[model samples]
Target chain A: MSELLSAEIQNCIEGPVVKYGYLSEQIDVVATPQSGLTSSTTGNRVMTDTISEAQNPKSFLLAIEALERGL
Target chain B: MILGLFVGESFAELSVAESTPSSRGTLREHQRWYLPKHGLKAYLQNWLTKTPHKPERVIVSSRFLYKLAGHRLGGSVAQIVTSGFENWSHFASLPANTRSTSLRQLNRCPSLSSQDLIFAVHERILSDGSIGKPLDLSEIGAIHEKLQVLGLKKVCLHFHNSNLNSIHQQQTRDFLVTLGYEIFEPPVVDAFPSLEPFTRWKTNTLSAAVSGTFEESMKEIFEGLSAQIKEEQIFFFDGDLRLHQGEPLYRLSSLFALEACLYSQLSKIMNTKMKSEKPLTFLHFGIEHFSYLTDEKTLTESPWGTLALGTQGCRDFSIQPSSLLDLHDDGSLVTKGNLSYEPGPIHLGRGHKPLVADLLIQETKWPEIIDLDEKQARTSLDRWVLLMQTWQRSVKKLRFLANLLSVCFEIK
Candidate 1:
């Protein structure tokens, strides 16, 4: 099967991608996934809920501290 | 007679068409300049009175179309939340695409409420449908006075645990309404009551911020055409392009960049340049180039944050408004993400700056809008590019088919 995909997107897909000219088969192409990046929406560093709380405080007073301290 | 009243940023047009069993017959359209001071309703009322046949139903797409088109709410909106959750909207529920994303570059996406306007009043509802803290009715007068002084009429209330216990929100809403204020209904709070608080808060607040403007615009269009058609007969479209009857929009944020929704729909039916046997991704190239989403994602599933929220899902998209600069030395194009709309008549020879259209279409041919000098447009662009080139170190020039899409990257 043929796929008209961007090289940027193709760099991210993990599985083997085959490029064929209409009916021609056996043209095997492997998609090498981009290094140092997860395919999932969530990143490698999943901050805990408490950390998120520090990141976005409920109180404006807490936010002042969150900003200076680099929450 | 079936009619469509389209209210745009600059002008409003009323289109009358005869709908047939098989085809849409010829359309007799009348264009009217949108003059807010004179009142849209009166203009519409005058126009409708002149029509030979009574208008059965009019689909009036209001001035909110401008806000939706450019993701800019007309007026400032104030948001009231549970005392603790003052910065609730700052925590959008959008997912992170990559680890490498720099926080500096990661913009705090389309915020509806002004930071100064977000008021945290004394009110709290526990998750168990219990009122932890009752509504502080005392806070109402001061808030109302502040609103009045600022000329800010619209207010959105989002209390913590509002889903389980809406007493505080209702009380606040009532209190705010008594003060001659336009209280906006929280987004999706009625329908999706169990949404995660962060997502819920962001969604509700964004809608709250834009809803007042949306309502006002709708009111202008509807009131103008109210003499001709019933309120129920008036129709509007969500971002998914699904026709909905009357207001209290399903997902207001989805309506941002409404034309992108149309483009999303068009991408589905429009034949692609590259025909492939397997699943294929589509890329659209025009004056301003854009890559369309995957096929499955194109279908109208959930259009909540389609345009407004600058969510970097799997991809982060940017917009460059009018005026493309040239990397003259390399014969490449360069532009920054202005994301501006109909960037004020520059190409029409009104604005001081020179737009891309001015460079290409000027003198060569007279466009839809006239009164332009091509030579001057090129000179202005050349001067602007020279000014920008001195500071901007990195520039990306993309060649697609024959056209060059020059995009300048922000390096911090």
Candidate 2:
């Protein structure tokens, strides 16, 4: 790693760390690209999953439709 | 009998319509139906007779029945139920054992907090008693501490805003690391991930041109460019243009002048290329974003959430024609209408008159018609241009590296 990146990482690690809720397992990798590619990919995947789930049988969409139809 | 009224698959066929004027008409039109005390119907044999175009079904769930009950019971009964009390006064007069059980039953019913409670109770009734309680901050800290003690190698710390710089956060990080936890800090990429470098370059160039006195700045920029690249060759100019510091009018005028300069330069380049043996080339330029700082006190309090700025500054400069005002300037801006008149020159900082005058300066050159010293102008332009070129090359490299990484990933 370059000296600049190394220094930045050190700063981040030694800097103030806010403790949130715990996770059961340790993360294997940490990817933080300077770009929005990862964020975009993750967002698209989530949206696709949500749409597919909504279209599935026994989904919330079905429940809402049944309620509307007085079923 | 009430259970029988609700029982069977056919019970779902019951259409409950509120006794509104529109629904009353529908009820009268569809004669073959039994209307309950709350104007509910057992069936509407030909409900679609009135509006054939709109075949919409209205479902009245159990919540409607609860609302109907509240309406019939009046305000006092509704208030008693909300206060977590038994509706009937006779319940208090019952035997001790009977009263105790009756009180327990009343308390077991969901408490009403708002009018929406009628509908909320339906969901509550359907759901199993397995709702999770919101986790407290103390509980979260304890869990994090436990994870650290377990010797977890990788952990993520998420916080909003300046909270990351707090002592508590620092202490937590230290505690985790001291316990042998390896906090995960992702590698940072050097270049902008979203916008193309050319877009960023053009924006910076335009911003610099409009940030100050146009002719002087441009002359300086071109002079600086003379050292690194020939004046005849196509080149890029880049520098920090602190455009927001001055008055809004001046800032806007600077932008207009820069636009005119760029258009002229682009036309010249295209004309030259047309005469030469070289293929046609295009120069793409755009500003991604721009921001300015203003005194917080200047913002007027708006009843409608949005804050307004007083138009007194613009009105003071109203001597200039309205045609000069930029698209951002509101033509219908109303003055605060204060009657007091001060002696000094009116504050034109808030107005578009400066911008209009500056735009005129682009063509007329009224103030200083003569251009700056060629050598001095060249020196300044050269430095800015070189800086811009260096940044552009760096951005290009970063883009290449990103593409290489993606290609490598594809191969893998």
Candidate 3:
């Protein structure tokens, strides 16, 4: 198969990130894997209990998933 | 770049995905508590200077408070003053039918006029004390001519205290219909005139207050203004419906505060070149409910300081840190093992980054309000930049600490 990881990883953690978990042919279920920056909207602002606070984390998850799926 | 003024909470309805009355109240509270400390206007101004694609002119409009705030942020960046008569007293207190010639003349003070700046403060005065009198076509004609003389391509009108009725003033909404001015309004607050409750202690300065009102008034004002002017000549910047709620709120971030300073510094780097290119456009990126919890650990270590006294997980995520809402066990924030820090990729969203262009619009009235030629404008800009730098330096340290904590948590 092609390389599972590439420069697109730069969108995440700034340094080396090694994935640890059992890799199946269909899905790569990994344990807690470390990447550059744990992408979260929390880094952007101190969200109160408002909808805006939840938005970043939700969107961040989607973004990470998209990147990982493509990779 | 033409400056576009989005006074008050103009874009909130569009920007925010959804909002409740209480949620909106929290938003306004957050704005008052954090906006000026963030130095939003200065930040946007600096960004305008560095942006590769900028308008040659700018329109700086806002609520009365925003106008005052802009004045507080003096710079070569031009401003256009537009709003209702509530606080026009700050500029000039006049009776009905007083030709703006004198007011415009007053704006000509060396302290007021700057390079290529135009000032158009339109007040709707009816013969009686009621609202919605047709804009004296003569005044509209004069304002229109002034804009034309300045060679302005677009005008962003920050409609403050205008409500829906202000739109009918210019020949029953003729002026705005004709000029095609871009209109913007801030998010709506629960209370129409929030002034009643907080009479004792005003949370925001004049500039911040004005910005909010300006947003509300734009649509009606421009609708009226456009009706009287050339329709094709103007464009309204209502702002993205989804992002509007958060745009003003985002100004509170230490990152955004620092961005303003950086932009200003960058402007100095290219000051000579700035004149040759088109005028710079300042885009204000406001975020909604900037206060939120990442994980419990991250919530404690954030730069936003204590919002209330409670474990974040137990409290409502929508609550802002103000007297109105009591989400905490005590009035203070709990810091035991607090782990909040700079928004990580996980926090910010994987690929969710803000776009610069879509959030900005062209305006052409900034130069006049700042009185570019005078030392006061420059002085004000300097002070604003200085304050932002200080805040940035402070947040930068917090970011470092937060990152360290994030690493520690990851290992654990």
Candidate 4:
């Protein structure tokens, strides 16, 4: 398994590098659990909704005040 | 070194899997959503999971595709001005034949045509007094056949507007039902009592204050806000809305609102005397485009107070918050979420100009200094234009990807 893995890495490194410039040559790839990746999509959705309210001048002022309260 | 080895092994496996006929066939179909000539899929499917009986393909209308390609609804009037047209009158006075000839010449130069300025102007005029054509029944049938071949027994069809009020949309929905495909209709919720009045008042008041017509932009913004307010109200009123309807009360609304609604509804179920025998599956459509749930630290720093409302409401309902969806922007999709990747902050790059310094320089004794200031201003303006163009292109690409992904998901 170790030999096979090393050969795979060697093959990848030997392939043509296109966009990443120098980093492509020096790149190290790692695999981790799926949970390691963090996503902010949910937070942004909420922010979009909250900001939508700010379209109104009254809501705009309130939004500013709300922001000042820091969350 | 071990990590790199593991990654290489994984990549090899991925390549083998992707090279399979099934994967290649799907890729071919997906490429239709992007520039056909490029043969690239509009969206990265890194985060997509194929589940049976769910939507496998989302077909966006040509109208949206035009917009994604940087053709605005009102044409490139703003762009025309930036390209040195003094005003609307100046653009209008240029003979149509001459303008067309010049546009054709400009098209020959790839750099000048990169923005699709000529196509936008032509499309605007052509689509005047008419909405762009809708997808026909034949197109829908073709997509259905493709999904059927892929062994998808049923697929969910979604339109951006759930009302299905448009003649074309209604006809499409009717045709799909005839073909025995289950249509996923987003639940209708009542708007908050204050929503309409508030939106109307704001629009009317702001229209007067602003110089040009603000109604168009403000109207769209208010309509969206009204829809969100309705979703929130439904979440507050209907505890069993998701379960009863077989869908979340709000699917495409704001992430914060969706989380709050889900948490509240789930809490009600948890606290009830009667227990549900089976686990409830909540469908969060188009959630991957939104921000992830706010972390405790970030929540406190957020300017939107409604975020707090969502957090507090969840707590009150005894719902423990969880990361519901992964954050995948267009750049992240391309990079595959590289740890070292940091998007350049477009907003922060806009530096402030000092009016006081400019005034002083203009009144100064040194004429050469004034010339220097003018040169600097011109340079800054050029830079600003370039940045704006880049930002607009990025935004259009991201929007296109998001729309494509939302329209279609794979069935595994």
Clash list (residue pairs), candidate 1:
A58-B84, B41-B224, B333-B406
DockQ of each: 0.02, 0.02, 0.03, 0.02
Please give the C-alpha DockQ score of model 2.
Answer: 0.02
Ranking by TM-score: 1, 3, 4, 2
**Residue-by-residue lDDT tens digits, candidate 1, B202-290:** 55555665565667766776777777677777665454445565455443633432333323323322334224333333222122222
lDDT score at residue B78, model 1, on the 0-100 scale: 78
| Candidate 2 residue runs with Cα over 4 Å from true position | A1-71, B1-141, B148-151, B185-412
Task: Give the C-alpha miss distance for residue B411 in model 3, angstroms.
Answer: 17
Assess every candidate by TM-score.
0.55, 0.13, 0.25, 0.20
Range of the 10 consecutive residues with the lowest summed lDDT in candidate 4 chain B: B1-10
Go through the candidates in order and give each one's C-alpha lDDT: 0.44, 0.22, 0.25, 0.22
Let me know the DockQ for model 4. 0.02
* TM-score (chain A only) of candidate 2: 0.20
* Model 4: lDDT to the true structure: 0.22
Selected candidate, larger lDDT, 3 vs 4: 3
What lDDT is reached at residue A38 by model 2? Answer: 26
Across B1-412, the per-residue lDDT of candidate 4 in tens digits comes to 0000000100100100112334421211111111211111211222123211122211110111101111112121111111121232222222222211221112211111112221111111111323344445666665556545544322222232223233444565587678775443323323322222212221111112221122232232224324222222211111211211112222212222323333333323333523633322212211011112211211110111111111312111000011111124553211111010011111112233211111122223222311224554565556545644554565554332232121111111
